[model samples]
Target: MAELSAPTGREPGLRAVPRPDGTMPRALVIGATGYLGGRLVPRLLAAGYAVRVLARAPERVRAFQWGDDVEVVEGAAAEAAAVRRAVADVDVVYYLVHSMAAGTGFEEADRRAAQTVADAAAAAGVGRIVYLGGLHPDDVPLSPHLRSRVEVGQILLDSGVPTLVLQAGVVIGSGSASFEMVRHLTDVLPYMPAPRWVRNRIQPIAVRDVLHYLLGAARVDPAVNRAVDIGGPDVLRYGQMMNGYAVVAGLRQRAIAALPVLTPRLASHWVNLVTPIPRSIARPLVESLQNDCVVKDDDVDALIPPPAAGLTPYRRAVALALGRVEADDVETSWRDAELSGVPSDPLPSDPDWAGRAVFTDARSARTPAPPDRLWAVVEGIGGENGWYSSPVLWALRGWMDRIVGGVGLARGRRSRRRLAVGDALDFWRVEAVEPGRLLRLRAEMKVPGLAWLELRVAPEGTGARYDQRAVFFPQGLAGRLYWLAVLPFHGFIFRGMANRITAAAARAS
Candidate 1:
């Protein structure tokens, strides 16, 4: 494995320790493509540890800014052979894999994966195993998600390998499942009718603090080999969290009313409709909110001192998360992790005659610029840059989308000058991006049908041609009517958009 060069400046609260071989300790992060794991690997590298990542799909991590800095092993944690290969010559193994988003049987899958990893680490003679688990009170009846986390931590500890389990609740950061729920809940609803679980008091930690504790675990005394609960300083209810988020976002005061009739299932559906998070992932998370997740003990502070900057305040954490969102600097999102058990087929893969009538408003324009320049114009569309067509019409559409619990244009594009698969462009999710060739976006707006807006740029003659296609697969008669109703605006909106994009490309060229 290629060694990670030591960073010039060391991260606070992380103590550097050289190995017996006069080299840095090698740490292997399983599930490195995950939100926490993705962020943690870079910290380990900066702290002078030779970092390696084990991911089921290595391509997912390839886009990460630190992708080339660390070694990557392609394999799932469930595979013993893959686990053993990843554990080889590693001092610390971070078992960050979990199956909460996988729906049913996740607990069993997590248990099996944990056992495989722990056993492999023991066989490899790895010094320590660090695992991040959910924080829940031991006295209360834990939700399936929280219970599975605790169970996995036990399996790791029982492997007879010294394991440090850092248990946390509601990680407040951009792209986190918990924080996204809070963010969307506050952003969408001025008056929130929440479930009783929203009243349950819990502690929330910043992702930065979570990373700090994870890095601190590497240098922690080997004797401390048990679960340690970690959380931000404040203890607040889920409702308060939403309100706090509102305050941090500088939005109008949100009034949340707790409703006794709202069940976790119902709340999960509500979260699904309002937030970018799907019901499969949101259901498990909503169920866990019933139990208070505050840190009951402060023993972890002694084992690993708090960072010099100290723990981030709840509101400050929300601000930081929002700032990251606004700046389009979110490193990794919960969506980056694959969601299993939820069966889904790509639009292109679906059967052509799947009882859905497909509609297309395809248009092409010859641009007086090369494919690269035209592609640049394509990538720069949406958000503050607008649609290059009718700004008023786009705003009206966005407002209508927001009224129906859609993401709307406010979510914006993650980058002003680039496009990536899974990045949000207004109410559309980037489905595919091929640099100078193609860009396809799947609409997240509430509509009667599935919609995609695709832009393709190709070298044509002395310059390039831009092909713009607005495709919609209608559900039924309502879908067809919806398409027909919007058909009048197509001539003005789409044609103008194509022309403007061409002009923009020409101007840039």
Candidate 2:
């Protein structure tokens, strides 16, 4: 796709058609599949706006509880026809869609999409265009994610359609990707060794406040066409956010150390292993927060009134979000008896691994047992089954992980004999499960790098070959050192693991 045409500094004369005061304002929400959009739609409906959603996949939008109540446009923001259809006859066109999660060339993708929406909104004469953008300081170099958001905001503002861009800091709430990252990491790890940027201050706004601000943006004065900063009351470091969650969850105080070795880019991948968020979205989310993300001005205050109860504090937001997901027990409920919405609502899929430092250890053992027989033993490896090779070594490793605030082996497999993708098995998450053939577990244990263990059974001769491989994509020098330090144990631990697993399968038969 071609790049967005240069924005003319002179604002164009095109403007959204004004609406009558008592008339129900029509709102067209782009990117309805996103966590923010999904939450925003319900609140918008509850607030009595005539809601419409434009989704690349309309089915995903229809999956929400409030799905049936809104108009659905079937197409992506990148498609001009879709954007035009979505913007038609709408009072407010909300540009909630972004392409950071779309992988390579996300910047261009966002620019193109934002440009498409901006032009469409302008042509349709929408009343106001509201965009939720990243909060970043104007002085420093911005992360790719933040820079793209800033550029998108500018594109919209230059479109001549009255636009109000709400630049929000780290958003804290259930189903929020950033909050989920902190939630899972803090829940699994007691001690976190994070990047130095963890010390960076961030003003995290609750989803409730974000929705409140967005609801207000719908009625914002047409004279407002500038980016406004929005954030919660408290400004705390990234590490403090995690501990605040611990406090709300009634967990022991978490120890957070800003380590120079761990880079936020790799850390993003590590956090992705545990959190249910899509792979593509996690990196940008993590990188964006590497720098301070607090609101710089009270620009939002002038445009939108604060929530009647005031903006939610960081810890209180965490507490409220925690109430949503606390082991099925009745704690926090956004709705009635049944939880209509899950906090782990994931975005579309994207392969996370691209260019990275990779280290691998491949080992295989031939077993007299058949592939199906061996697969049974492989699938039941974690939780109660335990790693076949070494109890002492695995136990020590689990302890080491737990000591550093990792998930450890305490969270066993959900089912003793069955394995499915995304299931948490001990300290490893089931990345892929091809029944009777292969099982790939991504390491959730606190390590210096992103790691994965693959166990697959292949037919060989009259028996089966149980191939085992461990892959590690180290972050920096520390990751390499971490690998070298543990190289000796690979033979004793992995080789025996393969051998013992095959033997167990044979015995099972």
Candidate 3:
């Protein structure tokens, strides 16, 4: 891969991806909306890369916190005109796109996409190309997913441009398909059956370390134009990984059975039933476990130095992923209590908040009441005062949460008419409050993801405008499904709450 010197005036004692001319490197990311691509773009920007993204739907890219930070070139990678436009004048290309979710003939689709990107990058004379692939044994027959990845990396390497293909296995992070699989399987079933591959060894790496190598790949020696193995320390069998997660999450050790009869397809179906991951994606991920996935050589280390803190161990990565829920950092992820700005102001406010799929619902109404009357109603919400909506729906949700061992609505608020940031209001925590303006509550109920409710009031035309928003960041597939199931109720819950609050305020005026 081509080497670029670090930008001038960099923080001392820190290595920056280098560009010889001391100018910012322009990078084109093909899968800028995926988990890896979403995380990589901001880091590339921090590392001094002028980023440009290629996507079929520009709105998806615009949804990212860094959406406005980079130039968006709209088009599918399969389209030559689109890929050509994205690659032009770009220094490096990050091929993080994979269509395993497309299912059935996803391999061919991946191949065509790779060929399109490779040709486009070569034609543009892109400085370097980086692609993340799976780590598998050399002698055995690779799974269809792994084979497709290998083929894609080879295509990029042979495109007449220097390419650095970093192969990793079982990335452990929140919302990651693999990590979510491990999480949900442990959380749902105390004893998991079947899947003889559970005994297979795996060298799972943390998402942070994966991103680390990706950033470092920018400075790999120009002659280094081949795939390298990247993994974390402490390799263990798949079952042991689950037990390790159990330890970190304060759960009992799980009983995992590796029965020979459980084929990959059957195992995937089982995983689909238990975890948030769907069968389509779970099949390939499960099939990958058919063989051990340990890194064979230290080729990656020879090119890019490991993180100074060293690779994150398996248990440590699990703890990092679970720490958010344990500490209620999900509430802190909102970035502030005032409910100012958009939902994704800094994209992810913290590393802990990364990898989640965010969903939101918002509504507004105008009331004849002044801002103070509206604020009074907003602040006096929850507790015995009720939510100014369907009490039956709220109570039913609360009862369900209680059944799941969550802190149910019985907690109520500290006061009937006032609140502070740390007060517990029923199944919610008062996160932030702006007197006569806004009140934001973080949901403490047991759900598959993090949720928040925001109430706002502003004076307008001798009246007041009341706005309400419900936001959620789903953990994984389960979380997505949970949101979908409740979406129909949102019109009744949040919309009714907004309207009722406005009506109450108008009557009080």
Candidate 4:
């Protein structure tokens, strides 16, 4: 096989031609590290199809086991050259890339990216294209996010390639955006006030079922090109979804009072305040919640036999979601975008927010090994290490904060191999230490609050319980404002930090 030309800029115009490898299927998953892509690839491989992934930063998609198990090509799917190279030898091209967090330009970005993939696949003579899009009613006023999904699917269809576009709603996976929203809303808010969308009905699918559908599509002959509506056995309201999530997550049922006052914009602000999703990303998602995304038709199910791919019930899916959450093994959800190595500018700040005292409390139980073992994990806390989920994001945010007169990671600690008290650790200043028992750092960042990072060790079973916390005390409206604004981010960053430390602690032990 000759080296395929790497995509440079825009994809060139190309005609759909029969792929030479049609007899032996080879599937290429664009955004293969994503929640859907991650699971889909393994299934495809298991089903006897050769699998390849096109990742912008291949390292971010760590869940994919490499080393001859899968082929990983590093490049942006939006780039025509990259897409062309990725599709050249593959029979099936899975268009799984979307810019949900790209904000206002998301639609245009999504369109261009889809066009690039379609054009590249067409040029490469790919056998078929499989696209997964959010389900929406054509008559209903679709939110920009959902509309982009529908439009992008159209782009793939326009490519003239056999396309199996599966339109789904509210995938019941632990890392899915809709599921995360429900998780946070139900877990954190015991008493809730929400938008009218909460009353809207939606059909949820388990991530595994989604993977089954995609894998089945890959195995079937290219004749099945029609758009399909795939969903779980149950249809429930967004409110019921929240109730189900709470029940599964071990939280009490939450009573939500639907308020007309909470517009999408306001709700986004509130969501951004509570969840780790930024306002830019949360607004579009919140707006889309207005659309009722229940599956309208099941005609495609007849074409693809349901027995071939068994479905998991909504309750079972919820149970799996809970199990994943407790185990913290969620990989490749839409939230992975934030964790990807995208450089996000620091959000604007207020001058009045100056001179506010801040403190952060982080506790980590150490193993028998030296703190160096732990620092190795701490040092790699946010970027490619995934903070263990996605560390690129953690480092990016920490870097941005540091640049804005906040403690960037430059003050992290002493050496990656050594640890001591009063040592300057990245943007943090060491304040207290007791050999291997504890290490505390007082925040020196600019904020209208107090912050601190403390790590303490204790025995748990045969290992140690590593608890990492970021505590913030607001000064006034500014301090309170800042806390609310970055609440959603705390969930991801904090959860990631804890997971990374725990993993590192285990490795050292």
| Better by lDDT, candidate 3 or 2 | 3
Error of 2 at 121 (Å): 1.1
| Top lDDT prediction, candidate number | 1
Q: Roughly what TM-score does model 2 have, to 2 decimal places?
A: 0.63
lDDT of candidate 4?
A: 0.65
What residue runs in model 3 are displaced by over 4 Å at the alpha carbon? 1-18, 325-509
Better of 3 and 4 by lDDT: 3
Q: What's the CA error at residue 28 for candidate 1, in Å? A: 0.8
Please identify model 4 stretches exceeding 4 Å from their true place: 1-23, 61-63, 307-310, 338-509
lDDT of each: 0.82, 0.73, 0.76, 0.65
Model 1 agreement with the true structure over 276-383: per-residue lDDT tens digits: 676667888998898777899899988888867689999999988888788776777775555563212335754674665788899999977998899888988987
Model 1: runs farther than 4 Å from truth?
A: 1-9, 341-364, 380-416, 421-434, 438-455, 467-509
Tens digits of per-residue lDDT, candidate 4, 89-120, equal 78888888776666457788888889888888
Residue 398, candidate 1: how far off, in angstroms? 12
Candidate 2 deviant stretches above 4 angstroms: 1-18, 273-279, 327-509
- Superposed Cα deviation of residue 148, candidate 4 (Å): 1.2
Ranking by TM-score: 1, 3, 4, 2
